[model samples]
Target: MVGAGIGGLCAAAGLQRAGVEVVVLERADEVRSGGSGLSVFSNGIRALDALGVGDAFRAVTTRTEGLRAGQRRPSGAWLSTLPADAVAELRVIDRADLHGLLSDAVTAGTVRTGRRVTSMYPNGLVESVGSGTAGARRAWDRFDLVIGADGLRSAVRTGWPEDPGVAYSGYATWRGITAAPVELRGEAGETWGVECRFGIAPLADGRVYWFGVRTAGIDEPGDPALLRELFGSWHRPIPELIDATDPAAMQYLPIEELSGDLPTFARGRAVLLGDAAHAMTPDLGQGGGMAMEDAATLVGLIAPFAGTECGDAPELLDEALRRYDELRRPRPQRVAARSRMIGRLAHAPGPLLCAARDLVVRATPAAALGRQAAWVHEWLLTR
Candidate 1:
């Protein structure tokens, strides 16, 4: 396994629980400690259950059950309010908490921090650079499989044959967690404007996780004041949420996703998973959900190979991997495409288009919107 993000760690944990030896290679000196927030939808929750970490996740995350969630205008009037019953399974989570849970699930010493995977091959060979040692690279081999769970610019995916590259989504975000909890006024969801957005959701603790997004150049300045300038006057808690954040800890990122779908997620003995395979816009809040589903599905499919006594172990491994690619590819790519389309519509530029978009949003019934979203959130773990 390369990269130790949610997907990679989840795969490692599941693989270990199946009695398979696992190793996780991460470039960072330590498992990344903290992050602002992540949205885990219903499908993601079910994937967690399939992975056996459902309870651990629930203990640390706050369910969005009773919160009035949906789209809103900059003035704070609801364009559409999602039905409470429709969104009952959604959860707002602090990334660090979820990371800690997956990290703990893996067997101790399984993750080799600071061991960066430089390259991998179909023959299950991994070339890595370890900390110190004059940056000496070592080649490790003899594995039946290699999983690339690295993020958007995955080395494994980049090294895959006919790699299609990634594209900028033309929007950027400033994400932060408040130093202290700010009063939410009993609401959680996104506030959308022309070419921009602001989101607010509570963590299990009182601190709130919020983000401000703007359609901007990929290299837009990471100015802490930009958020206030963009959202200070919009709504009551949006400004207050900004004020409660620590300037030094704010995170700025330009959203990007895979440029195009790969012909296959498999190359030789290696497979691509998570953002490494099909990075999509977070407009649907399904990015993390897709990753979790990928991890669970792959782990489940390959479990029988863990201690196979059959002489055709290699054949079984090959079949399972082939099945993984066949079963997993279409859904996520479709989700990514749908998310990209939503991002474009939400960020429609100028007055006329924005007005039309808002009108459509207001006209759409809440239950109808929920029904449209049901397909994305209705997945269960499959073996």
Candidate 2:
């Protein structure tokens, strides 16, 4: 396994639980101790269950009834609201807390920190810069399989000729958490504007997690003051939440996703997973969830290869990987496409287009919206 982010760690947990010997290669010195937060839907919850960490995750996360989104005028009147039932059984977890959970679930000593993999070969040989060795690179022991759980710019994916490339989504996002002040209490939801959006949700503790997104250049810099100037007058808790955040804790990121023409997620003995395979827009909040699903699905498909007495282990492994690619590829790509379409519609640039977008949302019944979203949140792990 390469890269110890959410997807890689979860994959390690599932693979280890199946009695497979595993080692995770991460470039960071240690597991991330702090970061923003994430919202996981029922589908992600089910993936956690498949990985045997569902209870551990619930212990540190706050469960919400559903997802609610609406558009507001700059003056703060509701243009339209997606019904609360649109997304059922939602939960929010601080990224650090969830990372700690997955890290603990992995067998101790399996993760090698501060090691950067320079390249991986088709025969499962990984070359990495050894930690504290003054940048000396060496080949690690070969393995039966290699998983490219690395994020968007994955080394393993780059080594293969099949990779198409990555594309900029033309948007940027700022996320942070603040201690919930006395005035904030209630359900969680998102407020959308012409080309911008703000989301708010409560953590298990009293802190509230929020994110602000807008259409912008990929190289644009982010400023908290600019966020205030843009959204300060829009709504009551929105500005207040921004004001309450610790300035240093704010994180800014430019959104990007895999090209729609990504070739194959698998090549030879190595395979890609998570953002390495299908990076998607955050418009639907399923980026992390899809990665979790990928982890669970990958491990579930390959379990038979662990400690098998069959003579043709290599052929069996190849078949399992073929099945993994066949089963896992289409759904996430479809979801990515849907998320991109939603982002384009929500960030429509012209006044006439924005008004039409809001009008269509208002005219559409809540039940109809819920039905359209049901396919996303209703996913469950087969294992």
- Candidates' C-alpha lDDT: 0.87, 0.82
Expressed as tens digits, the lDDT of each residue in 14-80 for candidate 2 is: 9999988998988777779465888898889999999899999988876665434555565656666
Score residue 365 of candidate 1 by CA lDDT: 88
TM-scores across all candidates? 0.97, 0.94
Residue-level lDDT of model 1, residues 1-383, one tens digit each, is 99999899988988888878898888888887564888888899998888889889988876767889889988989999988876788888888888988999998899888787887777998888876533565757557789999889999999876788989999998888999878887798899987999988888778898889899999778698888788888978898988888898888999999999989988778988899999998888888898899988998988867878689988888888898899889999999999999899889998799999999999998878888789888997666
Candidate 1: misplaced stretches above 4 Å?
131-134
Each candidate's clash count: 2, 0
Candidate 2 has an lDDT of 0.82
Q: TM-score of predicted model 1?
A: 0.97
RMSD of each: 1.4, 2.0
Best by TM-score: 1
Best by lDDT: 1
